[model samples]
Target: MLAVLAGCTGGSRDIGEGKPGSSGDAIQIFPRDGAEDVGPERRIEVSIPDGRLERVRVTRVEDARRQAVPGRISDDGLSWRPAGGAGRLALASKYSVEAVAVDAEGRRSARNTAFTTVVPDHRFIGYFKPENRSTVGTGMIVAFEFSRPIRDRAAVQKAIRVTADPAVEVVGHWFGRDRLDFRPAAYWKPGTEVTVEVGLRDVEGAPGVFGSQRRTVGFTVGRSQVSLVDAAGHTMQVRRDGELISTVPISAGAPKTPTYNGKMVVSEMHEVTRMDGRTVGFGGEYDIKDVPHAIRLTESGTFLHGNYWAPADTFGSLNTSHGCIGLRDVKGGGGSAPGGWFFDRTLIGDVVEVVNSPDRKVAPDNGLSGWNLSWQAWKAGSALR
Candidate 1:
């Protein structure tokens, strides 16, 4: 009956205005199938002849699941680019593409979807410190917060290096899960330059986490002034380049709360800083609320600063104070007062030893101070080649 309608037997007529073999067919995906070593963030483009790409979608690894990831179809309608999500393949197990295109008459057309393989065997981490391209005094540390914890800390520690002028060598030590610090065998030489380099790329950290840290941090070492305070002896000795420069009557912590021991590096010298007893477990059930002009000596709430409330007669004679080292000084870190003169001559990296304080040296990881760490231990935390 159809042949009779066509007026010819066994003859056929094609439908619509589209030529034979016109679009609405499967679009081709480049890179082919079963391809290996594809980057985790590869893009699959589409080719269309008589239509414009309306939408592009992707499927999960199993091919049974589908999702619409973000990407843009080129304005010319010739190519498409995949704008993967944050962390790229890190957020997805696998993905494939399914594109849709529309012709002139609002006719919809879609192509056969192609699956792309996702291999996420790569890892990355950061080596970031708080100091950003600035000169930090002895109070700052050559530190790095790793993005991932290392599988073998000893292996990674080998990649962290520190070099200083005047032939001062330092080491990198592990701090907690993801922090490492570098410090010299002694305090950095005053007026010297220090540089730290960490190469942690492709380094295997903990399970499934990789290290991607590659950076060089540099800072200048200021001055060397190592002072010794013996509360029992009722004397404080200040030395510059091994020369006995000055002596002041300095009081230290009483028996109840002593200062910390070890290589104590001067971190901050504020003319005044508010100290709260509640913050550091002082003032019993209540907080002192304010300890003014407190110079942070250690990370653990220790300060060698002016004590206006203490007896002036005990300035150089007695060890009678709270947990702080008390020195007589004006309101600022300068002027004729013994404390101010001492502060003016002191620079970063200068050492101040409170021999009788019962507290401990601040932990290397507690803050910017790194003097508590030994060079050998510091060198044992790198995760690089």
Candidate 2:
């Protein structure tokens, strides 16, 4: 028998590293070495020292049905991106991964098949707005936009849960695309408490993006008082729970100032904003453009915001102006202005219900206020389950 240094490796002798045909040890999967409970958000990665990756094949160790072909390869060939897919690796199923690397001179280096028990967590998916751990005015949504559009959103919707320490009722609505908003149907029951838990990990979203993680977020739904404005009565009634708390008799808009009708989710709030006519589909016919210090409420130019030029009657009586929920105020969303008082107290997720106006339901895409659609209708728009 020929004497070959059995499994012996020496420094700088470097006699056998790249000698492909000499039967030197093949590359092995390093980190994922028997990695168990792998993240459902599995991002496949494999590396080779001297060889370039030719192809990767994923297969079920047992079931033939469980398999997928990864997407196109990149130019450098060092990394691969899946074509919006997970290789359908079975959940909690034993699996194997095979990677092939080739050298520039067509020298082939093979690695021993790496084995690991692929387990799935209680797959959860959620997002954080303002970038999750964020700080913004009460007007910002601590929104967790899903990585994928959620299927079974209703069932998952109920899961997003809010828990007020005081045990106030928290309801969440599924917004189109991938957003679920939790509120008390009113404003969050103020001063109570709030906790949101979305256990969507592994939960199947649209088709490709799976709910691969879970998350929790809780914010204070401060102050329960909400002011409801009636264009007909010209009375803005503030209420806590169900009782009228305060009434602001103010002008709204002239008939032409008709406020939008529907459940408006305060998508955003600005203490001051630059309002330009061209911004809201205004043409030269109505040259009065670019109103500043405006408290923009809805996306379609409607605002429970501040307007300077409009008269005070629009606050408590017939509507006027080009369809904005006007309030008695000056420049800027301040100045002890009646509009500022209401606007100041408002948060982004707060509810602004406009009634007695002829305007149609605000379009869903205009902002995050998609709850206006009936459950049946909302589901119809989904491209996937």
Candidate 3:
């Protein structure tokens, strides 16, 4: 019986031959197929440890509309994400993703998947400036104006970050519940690349108010151009990186309504605009229907504009008009007028440093100008220090 059992055990069945070949390293995709109710603010990530992503295509399912999801692959050829490492899918939409990758050995792998994003009950986003991809002078400030007032200022401030490529310590100062501005201790370094990141998604900004902005904006700081205005001397000196470029005669605010003496940024410029004193609280004092080469300095209606109506002799010699800086120019703002020349040369964010004026310094919240406060005092205005 033992010999019979040994003979039975020796007759083992032949196991099937191993499969012929193999597939390359598999591509990994997030939000797996059939995934439902995914967060719209979530980023789509893809990776393959042994492979480099060759192509990635994401599109809406219903209309097959291709989503412009810009992606960057790692140098090691293992992972890929949005160019900024952040993004958001469209709400209440189904997305289909297809990816192709190649391994180190040149073997290819592919993946296809689909997912749906959650439709939010409430959504909020931030409105920020200097415009994305804009180039401006060194005094640019990263300012945001939310659609709704924020109740939790500290939390909101924490979600927003301002960074410089050369690495400077940037801080935020809240002008009010709905407005926040960021800047360095001094003006931004010339030619610095500034990036503004807003990561406010799903944040409880107010009582039951949810934020849904996950965006990045970038701008370049051009040359360091600052203008020194001597209200007492009735002259303006333009400086580039601390060197005098040009000097022009000017008229500041009258003695009773002196111009604010402080550092102010050129927040805006318009070729022609109407200046009505009644609109700025000095009811019916002066109403010039069309002012040319107007550059706005403050939110409180302070402007440096071409005053063709004022007497030509008053521009260089005497202080006239209401509380505004006046330059000589024609009605249409063309030709060799000093105002047009200055306006053409200057960009937004250029600094206007007013000295020897009788009035008080401009308020920090007056437009994007006014860096008059000490660093300590400015930091004191921050919710997080």
Arranged by TM-score with the best first, the candidates are 3, 1, 2
Candidate lDDT scores, in order, read 0.52, 0.48, 0.70
- Pick by lDDT: 1 or 3, better one: 3
Residues 152-259, candidate 2, lDDT per residue (tens digit)? 775566545556567644445556666765433323334544555656665565554456545665555454444577767877786655687667764454454356
Which candidate has the highest lDDT of all? 3
Candidate 1 lDDT at 310 equals: 48
Evaluated at residue 197, the lDDT of candidate 3 is: 82
Q: Could you tell me every candidate's TM-score relative to the true structure? A: 0.56, 0.51, 0.67
Better of 1 and 2 by TM-score: 1
Q: 1-385 in candidate 1: lDDT tens per residue?
A: 1110000001011010011133223345554433444565555667666567676665443211234566677888756766755214423233445555566666544433333343344663443442333444443456655544556676567766677777765666667767766666665556667666767666666666665557676667654567887756757798877789988887676565554555566655544333333334332221111222345565555566654444567666665544457676543234577767776676544677656545565455554556655555555644431
In Å, residue 184's CA in model 2 sits off its true spot by 5.2
Worst 10 residues of 3 by lDDT: 3-12
Q: Which stretches of candidate 3 lie above 4 Å from their native place?
A: 1-122
**Any idea what lDDT model 3 has?**
0.70
